[model samples]
Target: MKNTIIIIISILLLVFIFSGCGPEKKKVAVLIYDMEDPFIKGVSEYLKAFDQKSYDITYYDSQKSQIVQNKIAEKLYKEGVDLLVINPVERLSSYIFVKKSLQEEIPIIFFNREPLKEDLEYFEDVYYVGTDARESGMMQAKLISEGLGNDTENLGGFDKNGDHIIQCVILKGEQGHQDAEERTKSVIEGLKGEGFKVEVLHTKVANWNETKAYRAMHEIMSEFGEDIELLISNNDAMAIGASKYLMDNGYFGMEVDGVVTDIPFRIVGIDGLEEAKLLTKKGYMYGTIINDGKSMAEAIMQLSEYILENDEEKLQYELVDNKYILISYKYHSNE
Candidate 1:
C-alpha cells in the first residue's frame, strides 16, 4: 500500500511540474494577403485592441504576390514560430508553405480563404476556420432570385409567363481565389436551379484590384451598355469599382447595382464593408452581405488560445459559419 501511495505522489509531482513549466510565451506569425486591403485592416485593427505583451503577433504582407509570400512564410518557419495563421493568395500555390510547415510540426489556423485541403492534411494539428463560401453564395443567389421577383411583371395565373431574364456582369477575383470560384459557381447554380435565364455576358477576372476592377467595368460597359441589370462582383471592392465605373460614365438612371433590383439593377457582394453598410443606410448601395470580420478576428484569437491550452484532437475541417447575410435597399434611388 505504501509503494502504491508513493507512485501516486510521483505522478502528481510530474503533472504539477508539467503544468507549471509550460512553454514560455508563444510567438505567432500571420501570413496574409495584402495587409493594405481593408479586410485585413479590419482583422489587424482588432488584434491591436488586445494586450500584446503576452502574445507576439507579426503580420507579413504578400502584397498579392505568391512568390514573396512563400519567402516570408519560409523565413517565419526558420525562425521557429509556435503557430502560423495563413490567408493564402492562390488555391494550389499555398502547398509550398503547407508542405514545409508539416516537417516543422507547427499548428496553423487558416481564416477567410483556404489552401488546398489535401495538401493541408499533412500537418499534425491544423484548423480550417472560416466562412462557407458555397453556402454564402447560395444565400446571395436566393436573395437575387427574390429580387428578380420584384422585377418580374406578375403575368397573373391565366398568363403563365415565368420568362424574366436578368443581364449580369460578374467581376471575379484573381485566377484561383476560392472566394471567386465557389461564390461564382454557387450563384450561377442557384440562378440556374430557379429556371432564371441569367445571361452572363461579361465574366472578367479583376485580381481583386480596385483599379483593375474599374477598368474591367469600363470594358463591360462598352459591350453590355451601362444598362446591365445586375452587377455581381465577387467582393465589395470590386462591386464599388463597378459602381464607380457607372457613376463616371454618367449612367445614374438606376444606380441600382446591389442585391435589390436588376432593372436599374442593384449591385451585390460579400464581405460587407463599413462604407457598404453606411451606403445601404444612405441609398448608395442596394445591399451587402456582412462577413463579420471582427467576429472572425475574435474567433481566430480564441481558437489560437484553445489550441495552445487544450490537447484535444483538433478538427479535420471546421466550417466556422458566419452565415450572416444582410440584404438592405436603403440605398435605392427610388426609395
Candidate 2:
C-alpha cells in the first residue's frame, strides 16, 4: 500500500510541472499619442490585429497630451509590463520616457514619431521604427513636379498663369512636430533643388486636422483665389479637407462617369490613406507618399520578440546603427 501511494504522488507531481510549463504570453503596453489622428489610428489597428496568443497587449490613448502619456507610462511601469511601445505626444520629451524605461528595466519601442538621436542612444534596449520624414517630403515634391510636366521653365497647363513658377499654398501640420517641420522644409528645398521655382502664397498651421484644414483652405481661397496654382498639405487628412472645400465651392465641377471632369488645381499630400487614394483616383487630389503603417507594426512586433528572447540572430528587420528601423516611402499618383 505504501508503494502504490508513492507511485500516485509522483505521477501527480509530474502532471503539475508539465501543465505549468506551457508557453506564457508576454505583457506589452502600447501607448498611443492620440487615437483620433488617422495615421496613428491605422498603426494601432494593425498592432491590435496581431496574434494575441504570444502577447497580452494593453493600449492607452494619450489624447494628444504629453502629460497624460507620462502618467500612463508611469502606471504601466509600476504594473510590470515586459515591453512598452510608445507613439509619443511630443518628440522633444522622449528622454523622459527613455529614463523611465531605464529605471524600470523595461524594453521600449517607439514608432510613428521618432525620438531624438541622443535619447535613442541613451539605452541599448531602446529602438525606433519609423519612416524618414525627409524622404516623404522629397517624394511629395517629385509628385508635384511630375504633375506640372517636369519642366521648370514651362510648367504646363496647371501653371494657370504660365508664370514658369508654381504658386503654392501649404497646409502645415503641428507647430513643433518633427515630421511636420522636416516635411515642410524638405519639400520646398526639394522643389528648388530640382530647378522648379515655387512661390509659397501662404503657409498655415492646420495641426494635421481636417476641419482646421478646411477652414484654412477657405481663408486661403478667399485671399489668393485663382492665383493659387497648387495646394500642398502635410497629411492626407488636410489634403482631403482642402479638396472638400474646393468641391463645395464649385472648384471641381461635374463628375463624368464617377471621375471629376474639371479639377481646377493640383493638390498633393503625404500619407497614402484609402480616402486619399480614392480622391486621387477621382482626380480631386493628385498624389501622396505611402507611409506604410502595416509594415511598421510588423517590424515593431519582430523587434519585441527579439528583445524578449534575447536573440539578435532571429531579428528579421535590419536595425540601422542598432537603434533605428526605417521604413521606406513610396510615391503614389493617378498616372
Candidate 3:
C-alpha cells in the first residue's frame, strides 16, 4: 500500500513539473499613427500570424496627433510591456517616449519608420526595422531619369543630358518625419546624379493627409496651370491628388495626345497601393517599390528572440532588405 501511494505521489509531482514548463508569456505593444495606413495593416497582419506563440499585442493609434501618440507611448511604457513596436509621427517629438521606455528598461523596435538617427545613435537600446528610405527614393529617381527618353517624345518635354528636365511640383510629408525628409532628399540627389535636375516649382507640406493633398494640388493647378510637367509625391495619396488636378484641368484627353499625351503625365508615388498599381498599369501614373513589411516584422521577431536567448551585449545595429522589390508594371511586372 505504501508503494502504491509513492507511485501516485510521483505521478502528481510529474504533472506539476510538466504543467509548470509551459511557454513564457510575452506582452508587447504596437503604436501607430493610424490603422488605416498600409504599413500598419501589414504589421498587424504579421503580428496576428504568431497567435499560437505566447504573446499579446496591444494596439494604440494617435489619430494624427503627436501629443496623443506621445501619450499612448507613455501609457504603454507605464504598463510594463516587454516590448514596444512604434511607427512614430515625428522624429524629435517622439524621442521623449523613447527616453521613457529606456528609463523603464524595455526593448524597442521602430516599425516602418525610424527616429532621428542622431538621437537613436545615442540610445543604444532602440532597434529600427524598415526599408532603406533613401535607397527606396533613389530607386524611384533612377526610374524617372531612365524614362526621360520616353517622357519627351510622348509629352513634349525638354531633355537634359540623358534625362528629362521636367517641371516638378512636390507635395512632401511632415517636415519632422524622418522618412519623408530622407525620401525627398534622396530622390532629388538621385535626379541630380542623372544629369537632369527636376525644377521643383513648389514644395508644400501635405502632412500625409488626403485633404491636404487635394488642397495643395488645387493650389498648384491654379499656380502653374498646366505648366507642371510632373508631380513627384512622397506618398500614393498625394500622387492621387495630383492626378485629380490633371483630371480637373482636362489634361487626359485628345489635346494631351498631340503635344504631350504619349508620355505618362501623372503623379508618381510610393507604398505600392492597389490604386497606385492599377493606375501605373493603365498608363495613368508611374508605380513604385513595395517594401515587404510582413517580412520585416518577421525578421524583427527573430532578432528579438535571438537577443532574448543570447548575449545582449553583442546587439548589432543592422539594416536589412530581404529583396530589391520594385513593383512597377513597366519594369518589374514579375514581382
| Between candidates 2 and 3, the lDDT winner | 2
C-alpha lDDT score of every prediction, in listed order = 0.67, 0.90, 0.65
Q: After superposition, how far is residue 107 of candidate 1 from its true place, in Å?
A: 1.2
TM-score of each: 0.77, 0.93, 0.77
Which lDDT tens digits does candidate 1 get at residues 1-335?
Answer: 99999999999999998988755788888878788677677876775664345667888888878788888887888889988888876667757666777788788877677666676566656766567777667767766655555333331111122345666778897666777888899988887776666778788998766678888876788888644667776777877777767667766544344432322466676677776565555444556666667767766776677666663232222433321112121212223
Ranking by TM-score: 2, 1, 3
Give me candidate 1's TM-score against the actual structure.
0.77
Model 2: residue 53 alpha-carbon error in angstroms: 2.3
lDDT of 2 by residue, 1-335 (tens): 99999999999999999988877788999999999999889988887776455888888999999999999988888878999999999998889989988888888999989999999989889999999999999989989889878878777587788888989999999988899999999999999988999999999999999999998887898899789888999999999999999988898879888789988789999988999999999889989999998888888888888888888875788999988999998889999
Q: Model 2, which residues run further than 4 Å from truth?
A: 1-23
Model 3 — which ten-residue stretch has the worst lDDT?
325-334
- Which of the numbered candidates is closest to the native, going by highest TM-score? 2
- Look at candidate 3 and give me any clashing residue pairs: 154-263
Q: Order of candidates by lDDT, top first?
A: 2, 1, 3
Error of 3 at 68 (Å): 2.0
Question: What TM-score would candidate 3 get against the native?
Answer: 0.77
